[model samples]
Target: MASSIHDLARHLNISIGTVSRALNGRADVNADTRQRVLE
Candidate 1:
């Protein structure tokens, strides 16, 4: 099953907001961190 954003965040050990921001391509997230999430 595909994971929801909340599940993904929990699994990744990061905040839900960070996952959301990274997925949305927001500028506030660090580039490396965003890349790690996407991978």
Candidate 2:
């Protein structure tokens, strides 16, 4: 089953805002972190 941002964030042990930013490709997010999110 697919997970939502909240679930993903919890799984990754990161903040929901971080997940949102990473998924959105926001410049504020770290490149490595963004790549992890994309994958």
Candidate 3:
């Protein structure tokens, strides 16, 4: 699967690591951002 994690992180002003963890079902992701990313 090709994910836009880097782009999403940049637009959201967060780190790529955060985006990665979030998509992988980590507990540290911000709810709102995660939702947007998923969408």
Write one digit per residue (lDDT tens) for candidate 2, span 1-39: 989999988888889999999988799999888887778
RMSD of each: 0.9, 0.9, 2.4
Best candidate according to lDDT: 1
Ten-residue region with minimum lDDT total, candidate 3: 1-10
Clashing pairs in 3: none
> Which of candidates 1 and 2 reaches a greater TM-score?
2
Any runs in candidate 2 off by more than 4 Å, and if so which? Answer: none
**Tens-digit per-residue lDDT, 1-39, candidate 1:** 988999989888999999999999999999988987898
The global C-alpha lDDT for each of the candidates, from Candidate 1 onward, is 0.91, 0.89, 0.82
Error of 3 at 27 (Å): 1.1
Q: Positional deviation of 38 in candidate 1, in angstroms?
A: 0.8
lDDT of 3 by residue, 1-39 (tens): 765878888887889998898789898887987887777
What TM-score fits each model? 0.83, 0.84, 0.62
Residue 10 lDDT in model 3? 89
State, as a TM-score between 0 and 1, how close model 3 is to the true structure. 0.62
How many residue-pair clashes does candidate 3 contain?
0
